[model samples]
Target: MKRPDTRAASVGVIDIGSNSVRLVVYQAMERSLVTVFNEKALCGLGREVQTTGLLAADAVDKALTALKRFRALCKVQKVGEVHAIATAACRDASNGPDFIAKAEKICGASIQILTGPEEARYSALGVISGIHKPDGIVGDLGGGSLELIDVRGHQVRSGVTLPLGSLALQDLAEKSLKKAQRIASEALTDLPQLLAGENRTFYAVGGTWRALARIHIIQSGYPLGVMHGYAIPAAEALAFVRRLRRLVAADMLADIEAIAEARRPLLAYAALVLEHVIRIARPTTVVFSTFGVREGLLYSKLPDTERAKDGLLCAAQDLNELLSRSAQHARELIDWTDRLFRVVHIRETEEERRLRHAACLLSDIGWRMHPDHRGEQTYGIVLNGNFGSISHEGRIFVALSVFFRYEGLRDETAPPPLTQQLSQAAIDRARVLGTAFRVAHLISAARPGVLPATHFRTQDRKLMLIFEHQMVDLVADRVGGRFKQLARLVGRSGSIVRS
Candidate 1:
C-alpha cells in the first residue's frame, strides 16, 4: 500500500453500526488512518425495533446528522471516494431502505446495508488484509448482531450471522446488563462444538471487544496500543471475562463513565457477550481487530498483491516474536520449509504462499516446548496460538501445515461444514504441503539450512528422487531395512545421488 504521498489523499469510510456512526479517512499512500471521526450516539435503531418493529426517529436523526457531517468532511479533505455501510442496524430495520435512499440524497454516497453473512465476510477480510498470519476464525460483535467467519488458506470458508449483539441483548430480553449476561451465555451454547478440535485461531472484532481488551490492557497494565495483533492468553481472557461478570453494571458506574452515562446500562451487556464468546470458543488467545466490516469490504476491492500488504501475517510474526521465543534459528526454519514447498511443487495463490512461508518461520518455534514434545507443542501453538491479522483462509492453512508437521493430522477429517467452502484443490494442496513439511522437518533435524537438498522431479508420469551426496548417505543410514517404506513415500525407491 502506498502511504500518503508527500501530499496526502484521504479515502473516507463511513460505518453506520447499530451502536454508533464513524467516518474514517485513510491516507492510502502512507498506509495509515489519518483521521477517525466517530461518535457512539447510541442510535437505538435495534432497540426501538424490538418494541415497535421500526427504527426510532431519534436514532435516525442522530445517524443522519453524522452522515451529513461525514459528507462535509469528505468535501473538506477532498477525499476521492466515500464508501458507506450499515450493519445489523439498517439491515434489520423495516424502513432501512428508506433511510438509505434518503441518506444517499443528503450525503452523495450510498448507504450499503449488509446482511449478517456479508458483514462477517467483510470484517474477516478487513482484519486479515490489515495483518498477516493466515489462519483463524474472526467473530465481530456488533451492537445488533454477531458475525462469524471461517477462513481457510486464502479463501473464506463459511460465514453466518447470528442474532446476538450487546445492545440488542438488552432490548430483546428486557433485562438489566447483569441479567443480560446470562442471556449472552445462553446464546453462545452451540459455538464450542462448532469451533472445537479444528486447530484454528479465533480472533475478536468490533468496538465492544476492542474496548474490553483496552480496559484489560489498562487494568492489567498490558503495554502497547497498536494491539490489534496482541495476544491475550486464553486463561487470562477467561479470568478477565469472569471478573467482568461478577460486577454489577451499577458497580461499574464509576469505572467507565467515559463510555457515556446513557450507555452505561448497555455497556455491561456488551462486556458479558465478549466474555461468553471467549469461554465458548476456547481460543488459546484472542486478538483485537481495529478494522471490521467496512475495512474488509474496502480490502476486498483491492488487487490481489496489494491485498497481501495487509499485515495479518506480519502481525502474527510480531506477536509470535513477543509471545513466543525460539532456540532454533528462525531463518533455518523458513529455509527448510521453503525447500519443502519447492520439492512438493507447491501450487498456491500468492497470498496462500506467503502465508505458508509464515508457517515455516515458526514450525520449529516449539523447540522451546521440549525436544521430546516439540511436535505436540508446535501443533498446539499452530492450533491455538494467535497468528494475528491473517485471513480466515490463511489461518486454516497455518493450522493444516502444523498438523502435517506432526504425525497425527493425516487421519483427521474436515469438519462436515467446511466442505462447502474449502475447495477440493485447497484440500489437496493441504495434503501435499503437509507431507512436504514432514519431509522438511526430517531433513532439518532441528538445525536450519542443513537439510539435504532433495527434490522430487517428474518424468513420464513417474516421480524420481534426486538427492545431494550428504543426504543420500543419511537416507541410506536411516532407512537400512525400511528403504522400501521410504521409497513408497516418494513413489520410487533406491535414492539416487545427483551432483
Candidate 2:
C-alpha cells in the first residue's frame, strides 16, 4: 500500500501509554485499511508519575517532542483524520487534561484520555479482531497499568483495570520482585472470578509481555519469528516467569539489544504479574501476540460492514501492511529471479524455488544496527524469520541463502563457512541463487522494469546477456563479475554478452 494521499482519507492513531507514545497512519479506502506509516517514541511519561502524581519533566519533554514529530509526519504523509488516545498516564494524572491540551497544541490533533475500563475494552476489542476469536482472558500489561478482560464463548465480557503496569508498580512499590508481587497480587485479586469460565486461554499483550515471549523463544532456540499466534504452554510460561522472578532486573539481563532493550527491565515486573494472573485465571494455555491497541484502534473504527471482508486476510495482504512483513515486493523479486533462472540456465527444483522465495522475502531483513550491514544482518534475521510453515529443507534453504548474501561482505578478516547450516553442494547453489538476486538489483539499478530481460541462453562458453542494453552494463557492474561465474557454473559459460 502507498502512503496516505492528502486528497484521500487517512486515519492516525496516537497511543499515549505510560512508557511510550506511538503514531500510526492508516489509509482507509471503502472501509479497508492499509497502514502506510508507523512511528513510535518511548516517553515513559508515567515512569515515576504515579508516585509523584506529576508527569516527570523529562518524560513530558520527550513526549511533546515525539508528538510534535508525529504531527509533522502526519501532515507530510497526508493523514486527514487522527484519533489520539492516552491510557494510564493521562487517566491517572490529575494534570492529564493540561497535558492533553499541550499535546494537542503541539500535534494539532485532539487527545482523548481513555478511562481505565475504556482502555480494557479497546484493548480486548483489538485482540479479538486482530488475532483469534477464542474464549480466553486478554491481559494487556502496560508500563503503568494492567487491563484484563474476559472473553468467554466468543463474548467479550467483564474486565478490571489495575494500577499495576511495570513502571507504575516500580514507582509505587520498590523495584524488587517482592514489591512487584505485592502490586500484582493486589491487581489480580479480581482475576479468579473473571476466569472462572470453562477452559480459558490467556492471551498476553503489551511490549514487555511480548518481549518476554521472544526472549523465551530466543533463549530456547524456538524455530519461528511470527509471534501473532505463537503459544507457550502454561507450564513453560509460568516456569519462565519463575526464573525471571528469581533474578533482579539488573541481574536478569546483562544488556538488552535490538527490540528487547526497553522491555528488559520491565520483564521481571511483567513476569510477576503474569504468574499471579495465571494462578488466578488458571489458564490452560498462553498465546503471545505482537499486535495490540494500535491494531485494535484501526479495527474498531472501520465501517462495520467492511469488517467481514476476507480476501485481505490472505498472506500478502496482512504481511504487506507491515514494514517487516512486506514480502509481496520481495516475493515479486523472487518471481523475476525465477524467470531469470530459465534464461541463465539455472536449474532448480520446485523445492528450491519455494525456499529461494522464502530467502528473497527475508533478504533485506537484518539486525537493524546498520543498513550497510544488511547482508550481515540478514544472516540473523533469516534464522529469526522462522518460515515455520514451510518444510525443514525450506528453512535451511532460506538460512543458507541469506548467509550467502553477507558472508563475503562482512568485515571479518577471516571468512566463515559458506553455508552456516547446510552442506557444501547446497551452499554452492545458494551462492548461485543469491547471485541472481544481486544481479536483479543491479539490472533494475533500483528502477522498475530494470529486472532481468527475457531469455538468457549460453553461447560459446559465455552467458549471452539479454536485457535492454541500457541495463546490461549496469547489471554487469553491479553484479561485480558474479554473473560470469554463475553462468559458468550453471552452464559452463565464461563470458556474458548483452542482447
Candidate 3:
C-alpha cells in the first residue's frame, strides 16, 4: 500500500486554559509549524474557582460552546489530528471532571489535564524550542496559576507553581488591589528557581502578560510592533508595571482599544504579579514569548533529531522552497556565499553564520512581487514572520539584508525606522551580506549549477570572482560592477578572472 501523504495533512490543538479556550491549526506537524487558523474565546473558567472551589457554570458553558465550534472548524480544515489539553483551572476545580467530559464530547478528543509541574515543563520546552539557547526562568501566567521554571539550553529544572494568577488572585483578594499586591509579594518571596534568574533573562508567557507587553509597545513608540521576543530591561519593566498599577483600566480604553475587553480588568493584577517577579528574580531582562503549552504540545511530538534542528533555518528553508524560483539554488547559494566569505577572510560567529544562511535561503522570496515593491514586501515578511529562535535585532538584520538585495545598497534605500534597533556592527554585516546577495543573484539568475562553477579568490586587498572556462561567457559588465560593489563594502577592490 502506498503511504498517505502527510505533507498536506494539518494538525490542530485545542487549549482549554483558565481564562480562554483557543484552537490553533497548523499547516503540518513539522519542526517548523505554520499556523493556518487560530481562534479563541475568553471563557474565564478559573475566575470563581478560588472562592467556590468549582468551575463556574457560565464559564463551563462558554468553554463547551467554544470547543464545539473548534471541532467543527477542525473538520472544516480537514485537520488530520487534534490534541486537547486543559490547564490549572480544570486541574483544580472540583467540577472540572464533569466539564472535561462535556468538552471531550464536543471536541471529539481526549483532554489531558496538566498538573502544575507538567504545565511548567511544557512552558519551558516551548521556550527552548522557540528561542535559541535560552538561559532564563520561564514564567507562565495563566488565570489560575503561575508556573516558574528554570531553563538553560535544552535542560529544564524542577519548577514551582503559585496561586498568583490574575483571576485567582483577584478572587482571593476580594477585588482589592492592595490585598492582591500583598498576596503576590508573599507568594513569590521564597522561590529558588526565580532567584536563580539573577542577571539572566526572564521569559514571560501567557495572554495577560502579552496584553501588558502590547500596551508597553504602543506607549513606548517602539518601531517594530511585533511582540514575540520583545525584550525590556528588568528595572525598566519594573517601573512600567508600577506605572500600570497606578492607571485605571478604563483610562487605557481610549489609548489601546486593541486590547481585549476581558483582559483590561486583569491588567493590574498581572502587573502586580510581574512587579513582584522582577523584584525577586532580579533578572537583567524580561523577554516575551508568544509560544506556550500549545507550541510545546506540538514540539513534544517531534523525534529527537527533529527537535534538535534550528527553527529559524527550518522556517526559512520552507519559505524558500515555497516561494523561490528554485529551492536547490538557494541551498547552493549558501555554499557559494560560504566560499566567498572564506576567500575574503571574513570571520563570522556560529550564530552569525546560521543567520547569514537563513538570509541566503530567504534572499529570493520577493521575486514574484512587483519590482517596485519587492524590497518593502520582503522586508515586512522577514521582520514580522512567525518564525522563531531569532531576536528582534536579528530579525531586523535579516530583513535589511533581503531589503538591500532587491533595493540597491545606497543610502537612499532606507529601511523602516525599526532597523535602528540593530547595532552598527550588525548593520554593516547586513549590508555586506546584502551586497553579496545582489551580486550572486545577478550572476546566477537564481538557478542551480551556475554558482557551483564559479569561485572567489583574493590577491592582496583585491577580491576576484573567477568563472570556470565553460561558464566564462556568463560574465559581463553588470556582474563586474556588482562584484565591485560587494568588494568595496568589505574594504577591497574587485576584479573578475577567467579560468
Note the Cα lDDT for every prediction shown.
0.63, 0.67, 0.91
Write candidate 3's Cα lDDT for 1-499 as tens digits: 9987748689999999999999999999888889999999999999999999999999998999888899999988889999999998999999999999988888878999999999999999999888989999999999999999999998989898888888999999999999998888888987898889999999999999999899999889898888889999999999999898888544654445868989888999999999999999999999999988888878989999999999999999999999999999999999998998888788999889999999999999999999999999999999999988999988998999999899987778666657778888988899899889988899889989899999988889999999999899989999999999989988999999999
Ranking by lDDT: 3, 2, 1
Regions of candidate 3 where Cα sits further than 4 Å from its true position: 1-6, 249-255
lDDT accuracy of residue 106 in candidate 2 = 90
On TM-score, the stronger of 1 and 3 is 3
Model 2 C-alpha lDDT per residue in residues 1-499, reported as the tens digit of each score: 9886455687788888899898888765433345678877878888777778878888888999999888888888777788888999887777777888899899776777888788888777666665534568888988889888876433678877888888898888766677767766876676554457325788888988887877777777866555656678787888888886676444756464634466567777888888887777777888875556766666666566654443113222333324342345465676676766776666777657666665665654442447566665565555444222333334556666666554432246233333444666776787777666655544553344455343455666566556666655654453546666556556666445566
What 10-residue stretch in candidate 2 is worst by lDDT? 310-319
Evaluated at residue 164, the lDDT of candidate 1 is: 73
Score residue 146 of candidate 3 by CA lDDT.
Answer: 98
- Candidate 1: segments with Cα more than 4 A from true spot: 1-9, 29-42, 177-182, 192-200, 257-263, 310-499
lDDT of 1 by residue, 53-154 (tens): 677788889888877777887887788777888888687778988888888888887778887778888987766665554467788887788887776556
